[model samples]
Target: MNVPAPAHLLSLATASPSHSMRQDEVLEAATQLFDGRFPQFERMAPVFKHAGVLTRQLAMPVEWYLQPRTWPERSAVYDEVALDLFCEAARRALDEAGLTGAEIDVIVTVSSTGLSTPSLQARAIARMGFRPDAAGIPVFGLGCAGGATGLGLAARLATAQPGCRVLLVCVELCSVAFRMEDFSKVDIISTAIFGDGAAACVLSTGADGFAAVAGYAEHTWPDTLDIMGWRVRPDGLAVVLARALPPFVRKEIRLAMERMLASQGLTVEDVDRFICHPGGMKVIEAIEGAFGLGQGALDRERDVLADHGNMSSPTVLFALDRIRQAGLPRRSVVTAMGPGFTTSTVTLAA
Candidate 1:
């Protein structure tokens, strides 16, 4: 069952169903982490409800990833779990596309939670028996901006080569960095929000398919490093997510969208589909409220969140995959926010 080779595919490739921890499970875990030191759990009640997050998936079992152990133990677990996630996602995506590894030309990998020299891209290729000439490019430190950034790179390559095939893979094992001992508000929020997941897509310039890559634009906001990023310590990853991000999205994203569309000679009004990342409940609300997008602007986003929590780079890809599977209207604008405090938007003429 060969996937009817399309001209280009984005998030429309096949995706595995996301699994999550139950709500009671999260509350219990939060209780154990913050039960005595911080009474902020009650304060976060409304937030949990408002965010509509009942559950979130973990990259590894919480007990396993959060266990304090020697560096070797930690390294071993991270390596094992990250590989598991990468393989699961890669295989499912390939199967959905009805593709074998040999069909891929270039493998573009994206992730923020784990490190690897050969990277998941190489591992996937080697495990799946891909051709040796299949180039592998690993992108790190992009954080949430990775998916759009990967697509942007793919688009550039496809345009330059005029018929190239590229595989874009994103896998984030965020659970590997979970700090259950921390009761900080930001940490709590991150734990409750972030999830483990990966996504894969095949982008081609030669064939025509369900949705096509139209154009992409990226913008970096200055003076916002503290807005969101990681502070690596010997213990684990300490996430710094500012509360002001929601408002920032409302103010800056509109401007960014305008500039991105102008370069392509299009406007928001002309776009028939929106595949923006669900940064969180607030982030999604900020986008919708500011842009005055109709009710359906976030249909895919809501579905993805309910199904997969926040898989960072993979989240938006999952949303776009759902949208693509629905056979959405043509002319779409897909975007995501990442750590550079940067926003990347891609316009797709489906």
Candidate 2:
């Protein structure tokens, strides 16, 4: 028989600023960037300003990243930024789990927006003072599903070893990829949305962790690669988020949920709490509409979205941390969407 891990979520460390940017500031800046290329966006000033985003936090000050020569610097800014987030989050997760570096048998780090050799997990193990021989699972290109996928992999590790302990950290430096020159609809949409942040959790074989991840499912939509991805150009990495995503979620989410639940011998009715990734207002709205959930089903999601925007892989974990803190009834389900037009779901019991 497989033994389940006593995995609990740790305190989340966000990279956004505490002070909210004023609507005027956002519009004035956006207008300056898009005045000629996307003149139509000027009409969206009011809508964009109030579009469910009241405030957000960034890992670094805006000017430090938005400077003219920042992107061209050959200093490998991506790895450093990713390292900062990973180290902070690993510290918090280890503290929360009440375990030191030597106790962890495995380290799984996930990211889609950054690249690093010796990867985040290795650097984290070294900097965070974990044992040198701790196995490292560095997952890249998992996109938004990276967090839950990390959990899924960690759970398997816990199940494999009778007393194994695993740490999963998700870090995204999305702010580093902002496009001021390309003012297309996709650019504007991604700019107004994606934010930088990190979230981490610890899984253990003993029932001493925060909560237990009971089951999970992963699926991808083929032929939909173009729905969302990054394109490499001489200028830099460009984002592509299709307008069809909102409609796709509205139409296919229910079917996906049904399959996800059935795979674990569950149904939506059996789930007491729902922790969903707040991809955006449209994605949340699509989820609510498809699931027929009450208004409150998304209250926490709306709160996170208003506060942090979307931090990619860490987004769903952010919501799950809220659910864990709120002390909601047990038997919850956490779900998220990602590139590959994929969906990931994990069932947990508090």
Which pairs of residues collide in candidate 1? 6-207, 7-207, 7-208
Expressed as tens digits, the lDDT of each residue in 141-227 for candidate 1 is 888888888878877766666677777788776666666554578877776777777887777778665667778898988888999
Q: Give the Cα lDDT of each candidate.
A: 0.74, 0.74
The TM-score, computed over Cα atoms with residue i paired to residue i, of candidate 1 is: 0.91
- Residue 25 in model 2: lDDT: 55
Ten residues in sequence with the least summed lDDT for candidate 2: 10-19
lDDT of 2 by residue, 1-350 (tens): 94444444433333332334543455566677777768778665565664566666565565654554334541265677678878877787777667777887888888878667878777666678888888888888877777777777777777777677778888887766776665578776766766778887777666554567788898888898988877864556677789999899999988888898999899988988778888888888889888899655688888888777778888888877776678856798888888898888878876
> Alpha-carbon error at 245 in model 2, in Å?
0.9
